[model samples]
Target chain A: MSESEYAIEVENLNIYYGNNHVIKSINLKIPQKTVFAIMGPSGCGKSTMLRSFNRLLDLNKNVRVNGSVHLFGRDIYTGDMDSVEVRREVGMVFQYPNPFPHLSIYNNIALGLKMNKLVKSDKELDERIEWALKKAGLWEEVKHRLNDYPSGLSGGQRQRLVIARVIAMKPKVIMMDEPTANIDPVGSKKIEDLIFELKKDYTIVLVTHNPAQAARVSDYVAFIYLGELVEAGETGKIFTAPESKLTEKYLTGKLV
Target chain B: MYQFDMRRIKEYSFLGVISLLSFFMIFPLFHIIFTVFVDGIGTLVSTGPVFITGTLDDGGIGPAILGTLILSFFASLIGIPIAFAVGVYAYEYPYSVIGKATTALLEITQEFPTILVGLFVTQILVLPMGTYSAIAGAFALAIILMPYVAVYTKEAMSQIPFSFREAAFSLGVTKVKTVFLIIAPIAKRGILTGLLISVAKVAGETAPLLFTAGGLYQTYPDSLTQPVGAIPLLIYTLVQSPSPADHAMAWGASLVLLLIFLAAFIPLRLSIKEVRM
Candidate 1:
């Protein structure tokens, strides 16, 4: 497949926070419908890089970007593309489960659909919500409590609710920034299982500091250190036979 | 043993001193409440429902109570929307020039003497309208009410974690929708409490209505454009009169005003334990 077939293509993406350079010259290509994990140590700019993909960095005035990020052959950094639309197409699940606390579980899923006017009637909204929840593997457990607030749910359940919320938007690309970092072991395993199931339809970009998670889940793994990309390739090859010294150190117990 | 005994004595005496001082600090408040309840309740009881519902001739501050309610309600209606917008603007762009200026202005206005606000409104609204209208009084009170609500709004909006903000934005809604639709609802409790507290504060203010609401006491207020009398302004007038009868009425009105303030303030303060006034 050609480069246009990729879900996201980044070229020489350089980012700065005021005067401090955060993401140095980096190039990446994320294939469609694949679990592309960007793994790095804490504070190594993986989160920042993930934020840049959907122009989330625009929310902060201090951050500046000087690179082209093309999402499926369209240059998202170009002057005319609406950033809000870009974000709608690219959904994000945070490290912490943040499903709008004020909203009920059903409204949490319906909020995006309502905002975007993606669903027409109440019945359609209900169907879409049920569909998204089922896809997130949380429908049966939460179907009875759809009217309840997210604060009543566990951390892992909240994360799944957030995922369902994002899924309700029907985003083409879904990004997870350490989605299971704050969850319990059981919850984390369920999320990993959900991730394995979700990659069939949407492009998944997983950010993790854990090499074990990357090895277990990701089809493609990119190793980043400080502000630069150390190496990126098939997860198996990178884990078993890393060409770069930094990649090997990161995969082994030495780097962290 | 002597030194150790001296240390214990020192700590005990220090506690006793602070406890005494604290009691003294709270004594004036208790004394005021006691005096008002003692002096006012008799008049309220003797006069029956007339003290609340009848005119000054009928031994009631009925018009002033009505006027206070009207002025406060109108002031909140006028102030809350503008205050909320300014607050959200300041919270969204704390570093921008207008946002910084808005925050500073809110602070300065909060510290401002309310009498000056009344005088300014009197010059612009009262003098021009050629009468002391309820609108003018409400406008004056709204000026006083703005900074309280605005400051509270900004603080409340800022208190929501950054992650929620990120999550809202990630949903691809416009910044306006994200702030107003999503974030504003979450901060609604804080904003509501602030508005009510401001209402209580403005309801009991004498200076702001001194000139703006031109002391109506004979009958119930029928027009927003006509001269109005609030409970505080009426109490101020009654306290200065030579009549002993007026003194009793003043105390009764003061007690009513105190009750109004406490009614709005106490429950709100208790509901949000983390927020400090």
Candidate 2:
């Protein structure tokens, strides 16, 4: 894709939680239709920087941000821009699979569409839910029991349901923050496979501590250290021919 | 090894003694329920017609029953909503000075004695409405119930997971709807339980009503401005009287009051058990 097709751009980003500087000055770019993985040790600001893309950090009462993040060539943090509209275009999936305990599988997927008023009729809603579920690879497994509560689903199934919920909104960028942390190895692999399948249609940004997991899925990788961007490039080059000593140590599991 | 066996035996005996103390602690409730049945049965039989009919001169508790029902019902009707809003705001959106002040006031009010509540309401709502008015009685009961409902609702709302809130927020739902639709629905059962307990507590309180609502009488108020007689007030009057028949009506009235409270509580308790913990 050309430079004009860039999906997201971050310049001179700094994030603070009260007095603590959690994310330092950093810059990066993610193009359309690609999966970008952010890897780092615990508390290195990978998650903070990921959340800053859509201003999810604004949820924290202590958080303050100074810098600019752009989505599709538009500044996201500007006064005239609505945070709700930004989130609508850039959807997020949390660490744990949260499918809204009180709602059914079908209702959970339909919730986002309903919020946007994207569907006007019952038949349209039904088809939208089916399409999203199929995209997330959960449609066949849960098709027969659409009305059942989401809490009854297995861990893998719940994660897919969450993905389905987000993808149904037709967000241009889908961000996952350690989405497989709570599930088993088998379930993690399934989600990894699903993420690869998802990048064909939407830009994906994921934060992970596991270099191997990042290698298996991401088209590009960015290594963050103490809130600073250590290195970022094509996934193969970053892993096989890393220029920074810190990146080499982190990739070899010698320093995390 | 010998010392270990002796220690084990000592612990067993200590457990047995503590278990016996628990029975002693609970015995008073049994004594009260048992005594009411034995003491009130004869009164119920002889005055059975008057008891249900509530027609005997200077006797019967119809006015008191009517007063207690109306007063406590109105109290809960007013108090439950206030409690829910205060609880949700205090726990969920507690960034304001007003919310902080309300939470602190509620905590202090919960520990205040019922008679003090009577005094406060007498000065605030009761004196304004006039003593013996049904409105004053309702206000008195509401004052007693508010603290309980607020404290319990806050506790229940706090127990809800932050994940639920984050999930709702991430969905692009506004914070207000996220609170009411997602958080409040999950906390409803606990709120209902608190309201029921508050109802029972207000139903049985005699001290608060004494000053705000005047003694038992046959006259029924046509409006909130008029004097009202509640069951507790009637029981107090009959217990003070010289006539044996009047005293018997007191016990019967006490029994009826106990049953009324239990009837309100049983379903609330059972249904609350079904809510997700």
Best-matching candidate per DockQ: 1
Model 1 agreement with the true structure over A6-66: per-residue lDDT tens digits: 9999999999999999899999999999999999999999999999999999999999999
- Residues B1-277, model 2: lDDT tens digits: 4455888899999999999999999999999888787777777787765674464364566767778888888888887788777887887656678878888999898877888877877788766655557777788788778888888888777777876776666667777877777777677777778778878888888888888777555654466767777888788878899988787777888887877777878866886742332
- Per-prediction TM-score, please? 0.94, 0.92
Summing lDDT over every window of 10 consecutive residues in candidate 1 chain B, give the lowest-scoring window.
Answer: B268-277
iRMSD, model 1, in Å? 4.5
Instruction: Score chain A of model 1 by TM-score against the reference chain A.
Output: 0.98
Instruction: Show where candidate 1 strays beyond 4 Å.
Output: A1-3, B1-27, B265-277
Clash totals for all candidate models:
0, 2
Tens-digit lDDT track for model 1 on B164-269? Answer: 8888888977888989877777887777777777788898898989899988999888899999999999999999999999999899998888877787688877
Q: Against the correct fold, how does model 2 do in TM-score?
A: 0.92
Deviation from native of the Cα of residue B32 in model 2, angstroms: 3.0
Q: Ten consecutive residues with minimal summed lDDT in candidate 1 chain A?
A: A1-10
